[model samples]
Target: MPSSVEPARPAGHHTPGPPGPAPATPPSGDGSRVIPFGRRTTRTGRGRRTPQPPQPERVVAPDSPQQRLALDVEAWFLAHQATLTDEAAAHVYRTTLDFLQLMLTSSHAEERLSPDEYQHLTGMMQVLRDAPDTL
Candidate 1:
């Protein structure tokens, strides 16, 4: 078998690479950006399920106060991910936001969120809402 390691390159050598995707936000002093990787992986299945007409639909008006609040909460967490308790909480918050999206678009929000998880989500949102600068 060949060696497992690659031969070292000269110090002055530079390899061209594709420009990476734009950062969601400006990098901080550490040159790191926060990414919301939870938006997609939170939901998994054979495929998306359509709502059954027989089930009652929960309507959340796009401009309604609750919807507005949810939007604000999401934006805040996305911008302030570094301040969150941990990466898992940030992921869970994204999952919670996705659940809210399901509530608005389908009759199936309860399937992904448990009572305790929702309670924690709401508690975090409530803290943000209670902040002096929250809208």
Candidate 2:
């Protein structure tokens, strides 16, 4: 009895013509496709793209020294908002703001803080001033 098997093609050999059509249905004039999810269209597709609710804008403090200090402290806090959860971080923010308030009121603001405190406060001030540029 003869074997009912065909010889295999050698490696790198292929019987080729134009490749088969795409697995996906092509889009129509209205941009619809016959997908399993249903008749999907670019404009009329039923998906989870609901409109987002608008958030209320934060009111900025005024330009006076005290207000400016508070805004700087707040901006620094917001930038590092994740740090707020730590008790030590919260204490640092509170202490820095309090000292900043006192220092801003003095005629010699620079003299009021130790060198390290003054440098930290200046860094926070820079953060607030540069916020618009960064964002």
Candidate 3:
């Protein structure tokens, strides 16, 4: 309402609110909570966090290079997903992507994975990235 950039809303209709992030714009890249510019963190009349707590740092062991890489790539992809061309997007499956996203973003995504095991997941992502017809 106080914003000079956003046009005034209709008298009766509610002002447009952020339902979620826009395409290519993720809420946060480091797993920290981030509200978009000019968007309310909560809905009007809805229960919102009072005195938000400090987000724990997303730190992983220095030894797990593969795990670290996985997180970095997942975060990057999430932040850039909206920019992917339709042809590139078509090659990926939502379900598979979601699964990889979750697995990579998990606190200890590489807990049980060996170097070889990590390669398997990355290989799967690569295969899925541009899955071409075998026929």
lDDT agreement with native, every candidate: 0.54, 0.55, 0.53
TM-score of candidate 2 to 2 decimals: 0.22
lDDT score at residue 79, model 1, on the 0-100 scale:
96
- The whole-model C-alpha lDDT of candidate 2 against the native structure comes to 0.55
lDDT of 1 at 34: 29
TM-score of candidate 3 to 2 decimals: 0.24
lDDT of 2 by residue, 3-118 (tens): 32867557556434236775475556644332335545677657668888998665444575545655565577679764444567656655665676566546235476676766
Write candidate 3's Cα lDDT for 41-105 as tens digits: 45585566678789886554564554555455455556976322344544464456667846754
Best TM-score goes to which candidate?
A: 3
Off by over 4 Å in 2: 1-110
Descending-TM-score candidate ranking: 3, 1, 2
